[model samples]
Target: MEWIFILFLLYTLIPVWRQQRIHIARYKTIRKLESNRGSRVITLIHRQESLSFLGIPFRSFINIEDSEQILRAIRLTPDNMPIDLILHTPGGLVLASEQIAVALQKHPAKVTVFVPHYAMSGGTMICLAADEIILDENAVLGPVDPQLGRFPAASILEVIKIKELEHISDDTLIMADIARKAIQQVKTFIKQLLLPKMDEQRAEQLSEILADGRWTHDYPITGEWLKEFGLSVRFGLPKEVYLLMELYPQSPSRRPTVQYIPIPYRVENNDK
Candidate 1:
C-alpha cells in the first residue's frame, strides 16, 4: 500500500512539473522577443485552457478583461515607441475588439500585428487597425461581420427581406431589427480602422465587403487576397515569433492527432 501511494503521487505530480517548466520557458521567451523587437510586445493567444488538476477544458475568447489588460499595456508604452502585438485568436465580442483596435489605431508610432496562424472575426477587425500586418505565408484572417446568436446578423436581416411581414414571426422581426443595427455598427467600425491606410473610396469598399457577410463567418481570407486590397501585409513570420507561439499550446487532455518528425525534412538532389 505504501509503495502504491508513492507511485500514485508521482503520477499526479509529473504533469504539474511539466506545466511549471513550460511556464518558465514561456516567460523567458517572451522577454527575449521583447528585447529583440525594441517594442512593447503583447500577445493575444486564445487557446483552449485546461484545469491542471481536473483536466476539464474551457474555451477562451476576447472579452472585456482582454481589452482592459491590452489597453493598460498600450498605456504603459512610451509615446512614439513602436508596438508589436502577436495575435492568434478565433475572435470575440465587438465591444472588446473595437476597444483594442481603436487603441492600436490611435498610437502615435508604428503598430505591427503578427499573425502566425488565423485571426478571425473581431481578430480581423483588430488587425485592420494596425499600421502593418505580418503573417505566416499560410496564416489567414477572417471576415468582420457581426454574429447574432448562432446566425450571422446579415442572414437574420435577409429573412425579413425575403418573407412577407405577416409571415415573419415577432421574435424573428425583433432579431432582424437588431441584426440590421449590428451589421451597420460593425461596418462603420471596420471603415474607421481602414481610413488611415487607404483612400476613402477603397476603404469604404473594403469595409463593406468584409462586414457585409458576403462569405461565411469562418472564411479564411488569405494573405495573398489582402495584398489585392492594398493592405500592408508582409509574409514570412519571424522564427522567434514562432518559438513564442509554441509556448501557448492546446489542452493536453488528448493525444495530438497530427504528429511528424519535428525537424526539417529535405531530399538530396543527386545527379544520376
Candidate 2:
C-alpha cells in the first residue's frame, strides 16, 4: 500500500516539477542578459499564481515576510553590483513596503525597477526608491494614499471634514481625526523615501501628489502620466520581462481565497 501511494504521488507531481524546471530556465535566461554588468535580478511580485496553493488564490501582498527575500538578495549580491527589481503587485502593508524601499535606497549599487504590469499603492512606494523606473505600456502605478483597513483614509477624512460642522456620528468623528494623522504620516514617509533621489522641494512635491489622496486607490497612472508628474519614468521593457510574466499568467478560474499547495516527498531508489 505504501509503494502504491508513493507511485500515485509521483505521478501527480511530475507535471508540476516539469513546469518548475521550465520557469527556472526562463529566469536563467533573464539573468544571463545582465551577467556582463554583474547585475542581480530580484523579483518581488505578488502574483496570484505564485502565492496560490492548488487552485485557490489569495490577495497578492508585499508583506513583512517579503523582507527576508529582499535581504537575502542584497546579501548575495556583491557590493556595487546593480540590481534589477521586477515588480508586479497590488500593494500590501505600508511598513513592509517601506522596509524594502529603504533597503533599495541604501544599496550601494544602482537599483532599477521594471514594471511589466501594475504596481499600485505600496508597490508604487517601492518604485520611488529605485534609481530609475522602467514601465511597460500596460503598466500602471497608483497613488500612495494610506488605507486604513479597507477604507481609503483620504476619502474618509474628506467626508468627515465636510460633515464636522453639522451633526455627525461619534464613530465618524474619531475615524476622521485618525485618518487626518495617517495621511500626514504617509505623506512624510514618502517625502523621506524620495529625498535620496531628488531634492527636498521636489521630494515633498511628489509625495503630496502621490499621498494626498487626490486620486482614488486604484487609479491607473500610466507611464506618460507618471512622467508628467516629474518621476524618472521610461517606457518599453525587455523581452525577458514579458516572458517571465508568462510563467505566472493570471487564471480566470482562480478566486480570492487561501491558496493550498501540495508537496510530494521524494521516493527512495530501490535499485540503489
Candidate 3:
C-alpha cells in the first residue's frame, strides 16, 4: 500500500516539476524581451524555431503580440527619432501586421524596413508601407494574401454544407474566392492609410497584387519591381547604420553596417 502511494505521489510531482520548469523558461524569455526594448530602431526578425501553442511547439507563426511589443518599444523611444525596422518574417496575422504597418506610418519619424533574409505575406505588407525598404542581394519578399481564421473557415465550411444540401453548389469550390474577398478588405484598409502618400491607382494595384499574387514562398523581388510600382526607392543603407562604435560615439544599434542595401523609389510625375 505504501509503494502504491509513493508511486502516485511521484507521478503527480513529475508534472509539477515540468510546469515549474516551463514557467521559469517563460519568465526568462520575457525578461530578455524587456531588456531589449529601448533601442531607437527595432528589428522584427523571422522565427528561427517553431511557435508554441498551449505550450506545445509547432511551426512558428507571427505573434501579433510580439509585433505590438516591438511597436511599443518604438513608442517608448525618446523623442520619436527616425526608426529603422529590420524585418525577416515569413508573415503572420494580416490584421496584426497591418496594425504594425499603420503604427510605423503614423509615427512622426521616417520608417525604413531592412530585409536581410525574407519578408512574406503580412511581412511584405509592412515593408510596402515603409518610406524606404532596404534589402540585401539575398533578401526576398512575398505576397500579402490574408489567411482565414478558424471562425471564417468554419463559417465558409458551413455555407458549403448548406449549399450542398440545397443542391446549389458547383464543383468549382476554391479558397481563392475567400482569399479574394479578404484581399479586398485588406486592400481597402491599406489604401485608406496610404492613399495620402501615394497615387490612388498605384496603391490599388499594389494592394491587389499583394493580396492576390501567386508568389507564396521565396519570391525575391528585384529593385526594378519597386521602380515599376512607382515607389520612391533608393539604394544604400543610411550612413548611421554602418559607422562602428570605435568610429562613432553611439550605441551598436546606431552604428551603420554595409549589410543593408537600401531601396528608395522615385515618385512619378503622375504619382505626385
A best-first ranking of the candidates according to their TM-score comes to 1, 2, 3
lDDT of predicted model 1:
0.90
Write down the lDDT that model 3 would get.
0.62
Model 3: how far residue 167 lies from native, Å: 6.5
Q: Write the per-residue lDDT of candidate 2 for residues 1-272, one digit (tens) a residue.
A: 99999987886787578668867887786676577446888887776553322445556688888977897888888777899988999998988898898888889889999999899999999998888999998889999898888788988887876774568888888888988898898899899887776779988888898898898899998889767757789988877777777666564463585556645579888985
Q: How many clashing residue pairs, candidate 1?
A: 0
lDDT of 1 by residue, 72-159 (tens): 9999999778999999999999999999999999999899999999999989999999999999988999999999989999899889
Clashing pairs in 2: 53-260
| Top TM-score prediction, candidate number | 1
> How accurate locally, in lDDT, is each candidate?
0.90, 0.83, 0.62
